[model samples]
Target: MTVPTLSALATQLTSYNPDSLSVADAQQLIRDYVQATDSSETVGLNDALCRVLSEDVISPINVPAHDNSAMDGYAFRGSDLGVEAVMFKVVGTAFAGHKHEGPVNTGECVRIMTGAVMPADCDTVVPQELVTSASEASMTLAPGVVRPGDNRRLKGEDLMAGKSALRKGKTLHAADLGLLASLGIGQIPVQRRLRVAVFSTGDELRNIGEHLDEGCIYDSNRYTIRAMLTRLGCDVLDMGIVKDDRESLEAALRTACESADAIVTSGGVSVGEADFTREMMAKLGEVAFWKLAMRPGRPMAFGRIASNGKSAYLFGLPGNPVAVMVTFYFFARDALLRMMGGTKDSTPLIQAASQTAIRKKPGRTEYQRGILSMDANGNPQVRVTGSQGSGILRSMSEANCMIILHHEQGNVNAGDPVNVVLFDGLC
Candidate 1:
């Protein structure tokens, strides 16, 4: 895949300049430039949860080797039914994992259990509950009780032989394990987990459990980034806090580039005289510093950097508590997912009514933290958490969804519909 230069990417954009790129444009640029890591390993199905597949899985045989009964009932030929009640002699019983020795003749039925192979001459199964009367020798069925092929599981009904069961780049879920087990698959080829090194750079930052000075604050970004990386199945290297200086920053970047597939640093990306992180990043590799058209995370740096011929994707996020999360979610999250060889492109967004009025500008995109719940009328509604400041981590903590206000959208009135992305979803 060809990675276009920043200038070439700018030429393709007609709406904005590279310096002031929109959120959508930046996301697209990152997606185009970042490629999947080509590394794979075989893992047993029991241990492959949350792992992305490396190759398409084709079934070697039909899921169900034979036509079977879907319920415990009497299996009979459909041609034997009549207007009045029909009586049939029960020739024999068929249990699961056991088949009848011979086929049943007309007016004769075989007692069958769920998953029992259907007799050669039987075309339908009437569930035991639906059979009004039954005895050791015979059973009785009404005229409208069953139709042809009803309650019968056909051969290969779940999966056919020589057909693709799961595709490459798919993240295996619980149900996927069940399906693979049904196909008699034991081990699967999957992509290796991505290695991501994360750290915070600031002289005023201290680690948790450390004594804090008058101007120092605990470094939360590293812990936050590590937690998020762990959730994404990445092997995280937490480098702790690197003081804001030329040598320390350069050393950290070099070490990360040499060891990790991706590097994430929070703080010192904005335009400040003390912010030497950006300068050191440019010295190491070709990185683009942009003033994004988005709130809470306006200044960010993104590009590929290398040290000792080893390269890694770099994401320089902002310093604020909430801004780090917002930028990471909107920009770095999907990029890292792609680099992990995942096929899932993006998270789905839902539309919900705003419970209260919201003030906004139209030039930049805003990701407001919101609590989604049912309204008085039992409809989906969302309301913004108080104080939508970039530094307020409480807003994000309280939010179950992020109410997305687009770049071209304006102030919203109460009861207005807005787009939202949920944090929790059904497994």
Candidate 2:
């Protein structure tokens, strides 16, 4: 498949203005241009958690392999069961991993354990607890106690041989590993982990363990971005903080592009007197700087950048602490997942009632940090975490979800429904 350039993708949009772009348009442009990596590798089951599968896993053998008892009970021929109480003489015992080899004649049954293969002629099993007048030699079952094939697991019931056990593009979880193990599969083909280079740029920002000047603050965006990347199973290359100089910033971008698949930077995208990210990005490659119609994350940049003939996708996030997290979760998260060959999108949005009336203006989207909880009736309700300022990092820590006010949405009433994206798994 051919990958479209950013300009080509923008032309397809209804409106293309870098100065003022909508959130939805920006997301669509990124989705259309970015492509998944074609490279894949074989990994052991122990190391394949959360990795996207490159191919379908076919079942080598039938699940359960053969007809077996699903419960510890008596296995008998269903033809011997009648309308009245029926008694059967116990002929033999069948344990798990050991099939009953004796022949079951009419009026005779075999004592079977859970997972034990049933006798060749038996088609039903009566749970031991449900049997009446039970003894070592015989047991009695009331009429209608169990129908034919009751408590019996059919062969290939869970998964049949030569069938697709797990489809391609699936993100393997714990249960998927167990399913593969049950089929005796030890290794699987999975997409290679995405390599992402992360850094922060600002003259006033100081790294941890450094002496803070009178007006300088410690850098936190790099740590947060690294954590989010780790959760998505990316191989993060922490490039530390770059000084707010043209040469320093250019060197960092070039180094990142050469060694990483994607580059993420904060603080230099906004239009400020000292900000050179926009200019440097334009010089390095095809980048689009936009003033988004969104709250807390208005200034953003996205495009592909090349250094020394090696290229990488660049995501220039805002400087504000909260804005960095919001834009990443909403935009960069999905793009990175796609580049890694993952079929899943970002965390899904669910509807929740606003606990209080939220003041919102039309024509701009807002991502407010909120505390999502269950009401007395067991429905989700959300409220803002005090201030919704972009620079306030505490709000994000206190929030369990983000209350998303759409681009055209107006003021929200106290009990009005609103869209909310959870932070539990994504953040």
**TM-score to true structure, per model:** 0.95, 0.95
* Error at 278, model 1, angstroms: 1.7
Model 2 lDDT tens row, 290-334: 999899999999999998999999999999999999999988999
Off by over 4 Å in 1: 376-378, 425-427
RMSD of each: 1.9, 1.7
Distance (Å) between predicted and true CA of 239, model 1?
A: 0.7
Best by lDDT: 2
Pairs in steric clash, model 1? none
lDDT string for model 1 (61-151, tens) is 8979899999999999988887889999999999999998897999999999999999989989999988879999999988898887899
Q: How accurate is candidate 1 locally (lDDT)?
A: 0.89
Report, for every candidate in turn, its global Cα lDDT versus the true structure.
Answer: 0.89, 0.93
